[model samples]
Target: MPSSWTVLAVITVLTIYFCKNKRYRWFYIFAKTFRRDFRGFIVYVKTAITARLAKIRNETVVSVFESLVKKHPEKAAFLFEDETWTYAELNKFCNKIARYFRNEGYQKGDCIALMLENRPEYVGIWLGLSKIGVVTALINTNLTNDPLVHSVLAGKCKTIIFGSLYANVVKNVAKDLGFKSFYQFHESTTKEDFEVLPEFIDLRSKLSNISGDILSSRERVLADIQDPLLYIYTSGTTGLPKAAVVTSIRYMFAARGMTFVLRLKSNDVLYTPLPLYHSAGGMLGAGQAVLSGITVALRKKFSASNYWKDCAKYNCTVAQYIGEICRYILVAHNNVEPVKHPVRAILGNGLRPQLWKQFTEKFKIKEVYELYGATEGIANMINLDNQVGAVGFIPWHARWAYPVSLVKCNENTGEPLRDENGHCMECGINEPGLLIGKINQKKSIFAFQGYADQKATEKKILHNVFHDGDSYFNSGDVLVNDEYGYFYFRDRTGDTFRWKGENVSTAEVEAVISNLTQLSDTVVFGVEIPNSEGRAGMAAIVDAHNSLDLHLLSNSIKNNLPSYAVPMFIRVMNSVPLTGTFKLKKIELQADGYDINKVNDKIYFYDTKLKGYAELTKDIYEKIGNGTMNL
Candidate 1:
């Protein structure tokens, strides 16, 4: 028999040999990152297996919630500001809301539009509606005017429930939506809460009844796993927001996948400040907590100033975020150690490469579960190893099982390029391309439950992607997968532009510009240059004071952004146009461009020699048109 010392030497040699191979290294690192106690691993295995089986076999999200509630009735389910609600308490609250919904003659299959901010009532109302098999249309709270009306009307909402803060905005469009019922609720009831128009009914009065009828009646309407439980609005970039169907099964799969992948436990507390109207907060953050019987700390709105303090106060082991949130937090505090908290992991989408390592190391975050998915997207990814700049990784063996794929695309047109045979070609490794997911109708699990509009739904399906009759859900986002199967988000197809023989991600450039304290908001896009081969970067900046120091702004951009990515033209405005979801409305910006005659905003051009922004007068514009003025 080999001695203990001899065995140790052999193992060490093997470890050193394996560490040299990238594939072996990734596997070893993954195992090390996922390492847990024997008992914990066993529990994870059992839970994952059970959840997978349940998801595959079609399980309702409400059933899962009820199961957890029964298992841990006394457990704290949610923490919002100074208030805490246990499973039983939340269950009772939801029952009262359900009762009110039932009294209004709402039944299974009904759709109710909920246009409210980030509050505990948002979750309660959604759960109550889900309990009665009524689909809840989560409208973006920031929406008003046409977009707001369009969303509510598009969903065919029977009623619109709004918050007090948006009373005037909703009132302005009340005549347009007079056909639908309206109800209002305030974050806290005051004299202002009761000062709503007659058309807007107060929802607070209905909350007083706590009969728990839905619980004991045993006659509550239940939906199938495949039935729509929620209608989450997509961030409308080009048009009005489309309501994406969130089936109970989709929620189940997402919740279970996150719980299993993150190793979430009952003791875990997720501090979520992302809006509940979106999937990241409403589904991923809340769903994981429901399935794992963990607590979720809610914030009225995401405040970079209060983010760390809230995590520390709540003892949050896990936190959620978006790319903007992380960037803002970093920019808000530039100290060596920006935050000191109990957070072990931060999970969500949109953590850019430039801010990933900087934010993590500075804030002392151990892991970042960078996620990638759309409200209407068919596939998802989760980073497990805290890989800097990677959205997620797929193990070699599991690649065949998942429907995700990347295909070559035309960056300028935001379209997938096809071969001579009219079939989409898969992109080579490390080459950024359109991310898509296979839609197999035969396999229910692979089927895409698309938007409520059939025309809109059909538009996203790409036919004959690989072969005749084969379809794939167009993700509309550009990504590249490394040799180790780690995926990095490049940019959205529409937001990426080719400039100076290179592609520039508007999101990346925007992140850099956002770090500047002078600019409150900015929209970056490609604009036409008279003699240029492709579009040149142009930024529409919003500053309240409108007194931007061109030299300072130019210096900041030069230090952070690439030469090609740097905006050649800058337009200063009092306000930045934004969609309901806070996404930049760039259509008008891109159209107006640098034409001083057409645009009223002040425009400046980068002078190569001067190394700063110079006013773009009519003479300079004419010179540039004549190809005399250098960029």
Candidate 2:
């Protein structure tokens, strides 16, 4: 029972002693660990709060577009070679097209097929369809014959729009497919009244007659957030492309999430050379810009020499990329002033961890929002509040989750094998796994627009896993999750093949080879070596028409890939046959693999002793096949 003052003095002394000695000692260690986790938790909480707020208000993408038109009328909405369109101009253009669609008896939920390239008309058609509540099926222009005909008929499109440039491609396939009507938009003509071609309606005249003020009626057309807005086709690893029905809700979510992740503002200009047909260009790049009222600089295709020049010319603050595009840009000749552009950030997927630091340092880009998402998959990974080289984290959800598992391959056959329980176990951290999105009836959000071959669609749907009754979408991609829950891309399951005791992905090897300008498109696969333990890496390339610079090509591969992963044989071909969707047709190439005696193509083998590729003669082929030559 000490006096109150004496007790207070003792407590103060104890506090001071603890602060000076034991407490401070523990505080340093605690703060180091706790601060990182606490900050991560804060980010998680903030994201959750924002998501909840968005969900409560139910803000749709259509509403956001309308608001942009109202708020920023003078800002650039779309740009062509010499013409620039403001939001006001774009809104009017879209309404005119929408009114034409309505006048032609098109209704809500009707599907319209658009076969066009990267152009101003593409944006107009997209916005017009959105205003009319019609689902726009974006068809890849490169697709030909059956696949092309199949994709359009599969969506059950009421109308099809094609660029005048693709008229030949459409004419080759259209007669066979029973399309209701064909509409053409000619890029060469700027006339208000366009010439009407036989069996086709000109869009220009329809657009000229409609009033711009008709956009006020958009409120009635866009009343529902969950309505289907776009149908994006994703090529199946097995056969035909399957259309993924994208809703307005998903588009709105992507726009909001990307805007926050990229920290975009109205003044920011996003440069995209990727085609609008892909999700990366349409939903991520264009959608994000529209939502944030930012300007977008569109290019028909990517050119390495002209890329930095474009950025500088446009004063581009942001750019989007895919993995191959970045590698190609890096392979270009080094410049003393590589960081001359105004680009502050870049956002996209497929950027390899190895090139992360080098690319950022060279370009002087402060932020790299490397994001991950499938064209149709519900789960998306954004590296907003995380480090570079990581695809960011997704918290565990019992109902809906992507539980990745490594496919165990046979040493002899190279085919995936199942365990005794018939269940695949996931790989350890940083190891590759075939990512499978667990389908729980309670939480699944993706809807597959029926494929032309419905039976083909059924194959993509995996069923009865982890329970008596369950289903999931097979992503066909190998991925690994680190301890922090960041997903890292490994390889596509079908693309991974055994090569001299190593698993090789054509994409990984092709990515390395594409760095060589002498090779326009390279396809990597395994060619059987007689009496070998596994298949050896072989590459078939479309030469860049210059003398084969074997030394430069070999050096590039050696720098990027492991020794075993490098191609042992190289075949030079005039052209690489690609599917309608621009994806390399590997099945035929793998079938006709590297038998120099049988095949007509000029074959070259990597001469380790010579340090360059040399012509493969019958004698050398026999020696290599018999394991006499140490390849």
Candidate 3:
């Protein structure tokens, strides 16, 4: 993949010495590798070039989408269920949203939170708000109670627009939210959608009163490409969700980056069932229709049984997924024409090696475009060669140019390991190490925008990394690179754990559980189950008197946290294992997990059928570990 043979030969020899891989199988394999690596490098260069030109032209998310509306007016911009919205129609919907906010005196710097289920309107609302330079916070629709309230407040939002389905939830937390306005939107327009809880305003009614046309020049804010557009929240290593600022520049880089990587065509349709709050579904998926003039097939939510049917129905050429989608698709009964679907390529993160193989084979997929990145950091990677397990690859020679690298770090403390010279050490080939990205403030694509919380932002930056004045964005994830230069995700070295395709903070769960159980010394962690893509939640609490109320704990957790954050297993202990310093020691407890043979403490499993926690017997443990129970 080198421009010169000398560099390529040197790298080949080094790869052979380090990886100890068998000799290159055949000439055809070598030819294929050369082609893929070269092509991938071209994509990286192209993406950077396009992003820079957009910045120079002062193009933003709003301006880009407006151009597309004029270029492909009748093209299907989004397909949802049986509905299809053309590029022009989608633009009209967004115009109404922009006009409403602009007319209400929402200034350029105003911020509003939006919580809605995945639909065409979800993208429209945020994009519309961007027109007036009003940053829109994309709140996870699954959040409830305290987490939900925290999200709205974390964005520093003065107003919130929520879907009608969440009216009761918003009403309960309305008093907690002391901010200005509340607007509820009902997806259905055929029925009377004016219904709202008490003082809440109906967004649909307001929009209906206004003309759904393009905003006048005088009506718009002086938007810039670098202006903040969306506040997408992520649980970054701590308890509550931290809002990550996504500017028009950042969104364009990710969206346009994929356009080049996938060699996307105008006729290609993208199927995205993932949540709009997450970057995958929001920027990468929806960004296609807005920026690239491709059609996007949006779903309200993922349905394993209907996945393939939906793909064939929409004639989708591409599909999106996360870790949990693997279990869903593999375990489903069957979708009509499961193997005959038109989906050829997949784009998403958290697809394990085994899942990648099974998924591609089952669906006869031509390519699996596995990717890796975090919400705030800019260490983006893409698996271009369709390597079975690799999340991405960085050629040895390319490291000099690429901003990302793996550095030796303490697995326990989550700190980079420095040498006697006080410099971070690079991991050897195939060595697991912490991934970091060099921050370049001038380059929007390489900048670490960090979280809305500046203190939290500082927590993620490692200063004096390799040299005196250099700093790097510490991506809490650990990864390993092979002799072939392909990177594979190893494990996360933080308190956060992934479940149900969402990041569940142990600190958050502990707080909620401890509060419900009379201030018990509760510790929460993740436990691994065989055949599961991600870890399952488990909690340990001190209850020497055997007075812990399972019913109350279950109800409280369900009401406070998202369903995924609720622990699947709970262990009752007389006292939690603590270190000599009186800190809760989670290492051994997480290792014991819910194994009946290993865990001597009383263990209980959340019984969905019973609507409460039930004693975790040996039989129940066996059923869960062996994949026999669907519960």
Top model by lDDT, which number? 3
TM-score of 2: 0.70
lDDT of 1 at 353: 76
For candidate 2, the per-residue lDDT at 7 reads 95
Please, what are the lDDT tens digits per residue for candidate 3 over residues 1-631? 5578889889988778755654443344456468777998899899989999998998998888899998879999999989999989998999899999888888797889998899999999988888888999999998888888998888889899999888888888989998667888887886664467668888888899988877888888878888888999998887788999898889999999999988899999999999989999999999999899999999998998888889999999999998789668877844434466888898888888877777787778898899999867878899997898889888765777786999998887567899998989999888999999999898877888887789989999988888999889999989999766789998887898898899999988988887778756988888888888788899988899989888888888899889888899998999888889998888888888888898788899989899789998888888997988755
Candidates in order, TM-scores: namely: 0.74, 0.70, 0.94
Ranking by TM-score: 3, 1, 2
Off by over 4 Å in 1: 1-52, 55-58, 190-194, 216-219, 236-238, 335-338, 442-445, 495-631
The global C-alpha lDDT for each of the candidates, from Candidate 1 onward, is: 0.77, 0.69, 0.87
Candidate 1 residues 1-631, lDDT tens each? 9999999999998888876754466666456545322333454356556645775665677777777788988888889888888888877777888878887889898889988888677888888888877889998775656557878888888888888888887888889887556788766866653576677777876577547644545547856777898999764223446788888767766666677766787788889998888788888888765666879999988998899999999999999987668866876676545567999988877676767888888898888888887767766677766778888766544556676888999875569999999999888779999999888755545678888888878888999999998899988888999766778987666666656533466766776687774464888888866644457899988877857778888997876555767899999888877779987678878878899999888899999988889999999999988967757
Q: For residues 1-631, could you state the per-residue lDDT of candidate 2 as single tens digits? A: 8999999999999889878845655555445445444544554444445545545676566667778889989989766556777888877778777878877888788889998888766877877877878889998765665557767877878778988777766777778776667888776566653444677777766567777675566433754666777888765453345677777666655666676667677778888887788788888878865666888888887787777788888878888887656766776636545547999888877677777887888888788888766776644566654366776555332113234333444323223445576654445657765666654333223343323356755666666544446555666666666545566765555655654322455665676677664455888887776644446788998874745677788886765455767798898888888889898877678778878767788888989998778899999988987867867
Per candidate, the number of residue pairs that clash is 1, 1, 0
Q: How accurate locally is residue 278 in candidate 2, as Cα lDDT from 0 to 100?
A: 77
RMSD of 3: 4.1
Candidate 3 residue spans exceeding 4 A from truth: 1-32, 192-194, 333-338
- Candidates, ranked, lDDT: 3, 1, 2
